[model samples]
Each structure stands twice: as structure tokens, then as C-alpha cells.
Target: MEAPVYTALAERWQDQAGLARLAERAERRLREHPHGDLTRWRDALSRLPPVEPSADLDRPDPRLGATAPDLQGLGETLMDLHPWRKGPLVLGGIRIDTEWRSDWKWERVTPYIDLGGARVLDIGCGNGYFGLRMLGAGAELVVGVDPTLLFVMQYLVCRHFGGDLPNYVLPLGIEDLPEGLGGWDAVFSMGVLYHRRNPMRHLRRLRRLLKTGGTLVLETLVLPISRPGDLLVPDGRYARMRNVWAIPGTDRLLGWVNEAGFENARLVDMRPTTTSEQRSTPWMTFESLEQALEPGDGSRTIEGLPAPVRAVIVATA
Candidate 1:
């Protein structure tokens, strides 16, 4: 049986042939990358009580539904999906304090763009948190793509209470997107650029997915460099993440955005990531920002590299 996400996509995104095929491909991809604990996760999802709660996505912690009868049991079931990274969601009266205070990042980006009735594409969207925020900001539709199956399941947990909103999170990577698929009003690639080995190619791909004059919101780690074209190709692991391949200076990032066919690319926000923004919580008990930084000095990573300073760049495609 097809998931509700695919069913919703078949109806809401029926006008787009590419999205239709994408829905099919996404199912196949999930089948290929099946997780061992998927059954357990599904069982927990099945255990959720039938309650269609009202959602308030505009708040710092997106509030969903009121306090239910079996609040303690509900919280335990939700705990089955551990390590919640992107949110501090209030679901069915239980507060899920996630690893990252994603609200701060959202606040930084919201003032720069207008999502009123816009069609959005969010690359590397973890459990559709920003997608919900986009809907709250008046977006018509939000299609989020991420490779992590765990995040997809987390999104399902949210959907259990939030109902079938327009915010859909597909378990697919940016590379899995159909080539030449354009016409998005806005495209957001947050905390994803540095992970790509080829940053320029990734930026170009984001450009190809946007309509002419569409908005591109790119957020990624950066180094403090003097030159416009300078970037750091980390020799080894940076911030305990092996997949991070490139860390560009803000100027170099803007230069690459302009080179990749985006017009008027400019940096809008820049701030060093702090422990307060990303720390170990009950929902996400794993090592966090504090562990990644140097023991005595938070100014540098454990590997002696400069600490993570993320920059948000906005451009016209």
C-alpha cells in the first residue's frame, strides 16, 4: 500500500509530471534503504491515539493539539523516535525539546523572504520543521527532500497529530531530484551545502530547480577568510562530521552563487553556532555542539579548526 504522503502528492501535485515521477521514485528509494528499526517505528506510529489536533506552526515551538488523556504514554510512544534534531515541537501537550533550537535559524531567515502563497522546495529538510514554518508564513505548498529515513518517520509522527497538511517530507536526496525540474517560487538549502563534495554543482542544482526570478536561500558553514574566492577543503573530519567536504568564506559563497547563474547573491546573516542553539536534550541525548567544540575553548573545533560559523545567503535565480 502507498503511504499517505504519496496519496496526497498524487492529488495535490498532480499537475506536475516530474513530481508525479518523483513520488514513485521516492517509494522505490525507501524500499532500497530499509532501516532495521522501521517495524518498531511503525508500531509506535500505530499506537498513537486518533486525535486531529489544531496546529500553530507560527510559534517558536510549533504547537499541535491540546493535552490528551494518556499524556505520559503518548510521550513514551513519541520517544521511540529518538534524537529529534530540528525542532522543539509541542505535540498533544507533550513538549519535545529537540537537539537544535531551529526556531532561531528560522527567525533569522524569515525577515528576508516573503513566502505569501509561494511554492517552496526545501533541500535537506529534516522532518519538515521548516516546511511547517513555511506553511505558517503563508506558503501555498512545501515539498521537502531529505535522505534520512529516520527524519521521514519523525515527520510521520508529526503528521499523526497535524493531519494531512501541505508540508510533505520525501525521503530523497537533492541528487535524486529529476533533472531540469524548475518553477519553484523559493528553494531553501539549509545546513546542506558543506556536506556536498562539489559545492558549486550543488548550488547549480538548486538554481536549476527554481523558476526564473525565484528565491534561493542557502545556509551553510563558512570560514573567516579575507579573499572572495578562498574556501577550506578540510583535510580531515571537521566538527566530528566525516561528510563535510567544503567550508567557504562568506564572500566565496556569494561568488559561487553568482557564478552558478544566480543574480544579486548576497549574504544576509552570519553567526557562530553556539551550544545553546544545539545541545543534548532528553529527546536527543547524543553528543552535540559542546562535545564537537574544543574542551576549554569553544572558539575552535576539537580538530583545531575554526569553530562553525554559518552564513545565510539569498539570491535571485
Candidate 2:
């Protein structure tokens, strides 16, 4: 059977040019991927008893509970999909503490963009957490793209509880999207630019995905330097993350954005990541930000690089 998430998205976006093809390609890729745990995840998701989701997107808790009858059952089913990375999701009164304080990121982002009735695309959206928040902020539709199957499953669980809202997270990457298929009013590329091997290509692609005068909300790890050309090309990894290719300074980031054909790019916010914002919890038991930091200095990463400091830049496409 086709996943209800995909079916609903296909039906709703069928008339939108190029959306149907993208959805079809995403479905095909999902089927071909060898995800051995998909069946178990699906079973766990099916066990979640239906309840009217009470989404409090404006608050720190983006909850999905409302006097649920089977709180214990809901918690148990949610735990079956462990290592929750991007949430502090409250389901049936149980707080599934995630690895990252995605709420902090949301708080930093939501203030700058006008989501009202905007067609938004979230690149590398993990579990559709921010997408849900965008919907709550009055976005017309939110399309999140990420290649990870586990995150897709996690999103499915939220979708099931959140009801048939106009938000969809596809198991595909930014590269999977066709170029010049512009319609989105706002494009968000958070925690994703550093992971791209070619940051310029990624930026240009984001520009192509948006309509003229569209907003691009970009948040990524940045080096704490004042120079325009200074960028840290990690020899191997940055903060224990292997895929991080480049960490640019604020000026360098702006330069890149302007060079990528974006206009009026300006850094809006920059803050060092805190242990309080990200730490190991009962729901996410894996090594976290606290563990990733250097034991002696606490400011530098375990690899002796400058600690993770993120910057949010708003640009015009």
C-alpha cells in the first residue's frame, strides 16, 4: 500500500508543475532503499491510537496530545523509534527529549520570516518538526526534503497524530529536486549548508527553488572570525560530524550568498551552541553535544576545532 503521507501530498500537489514528478521519484527511491527497520517502524506507528493533536507551535513544546486515552501506549510506541534527533515532542503527555533543541533553532528562525500563506520548502528537514511549526505559523504548504529513512519514519508518526495537515516530508535530498522549478515563497536551508560538498551549488540550488523576491532562511555552523575569505576546511570532521565540509565566517558566508546570485543577504543572528540546548536525554541516549565538546576547554570541539557556533542569514532569491 502507498504511504498515506505520499498519497496525500501527491493529490494536493498534483496540479503544481514538477511537484508530481518529484513526488514520484521520491516514492521510487524510498521503495528501492534497503531499509530493514522500515517494517518495524511502520508497525510501531500503526500502534499509536488516534487522538486530536493539540499543536502548540508558538510555545517551547510543539505537542501532539489532547487527553489521550492510552498515554502509556503512545509513549511506548514512540520510543520504538529511538534516537530522536530533532524534537522535544510531547505525545500523550510524554516528553520525548530529542538530541538537538530544535526549538531553539525555531525561535531563532520564526521571527524573521513571514510564513503567512507562503509556500515553504525546508531542505534537510529532520522529522518535519520545523515544517509543523511553519504550518502553525500560517504557511499555506510546507514541503520538507531529507534522504534519511529513519527521519522519514519519525515524521510519519508525527503526521499520523498531527492529522491531515498540509505538510509533507519526502525521503529525498536537495539534489533530488529539479532545478528552476520555482514557486516557493520561502526556502529554508538550516543545518544543511555545511554538509554539502559544494556549498555554492547548494546555495544556488536553493535560489532556484524560490520565486523572485522569495526569502531564504539559511542557518549553518560558522567559524568565529572577522575575515571575509577565512573558512575552515576540516581535514576530516568538525565536532565529530564527518560530513561537515566547510565552516565559513560570517563575512565569507555573506560573500558566498551574494556570489551565488542571492541579493540583500545579511547575517541576522549568531550564537554559540550550549549544552543546555543539546544534551543526552532518556529519549535520545546517544553521545550528544556535551560529549562532543573538548573535556578540558569545553569551548573547543574534541578534535581541537572551534566549537559549533551557528549563524542565521536571511537573503532574497
| Candidate 2 C-alpha lDDT tens digits along 10-103 | 5665556778777777788777778899888878977878777666665566777565687777778888999898987776677878988888
lDDT of 1 at 273: 93
Question: Model 1, range 1-317, lDDT digits (tens) per residue?
Answer: 43545656756755666888888787776666668888888888888877766789888888876666799999899999897899989888899999999999999999999999998999999999999999999998999999899999898878878877888889999999998467899999999999998999999999999999999999999996533456778898999999899998877788899999999888999989999999999999899999999999988899988899999999999
TM-score of 1: 0.96
Off by over 4 Å in 2: 10-15, 53-56, 226-229
Instruction: Give the runs in model 1 whose Cα sits over 4 Å from its true position.
Output: 1-3, 225-229
RMSD of each: 1.7, 1.9
lDDT for position 286 in model 1: 94
Candidate of highest lDDT? 1
Number of clashing residue pairs in every model?
0, 0
Instruction: Report residue 47 deviation for candidate 1 (angstroms).
Output: 1.1
Question: Where does the lowest 10-residue lDDT sum fall in candidate 2?
Answer: 1-10
* Candidate 2 similarity to native, TM-score: 0.94
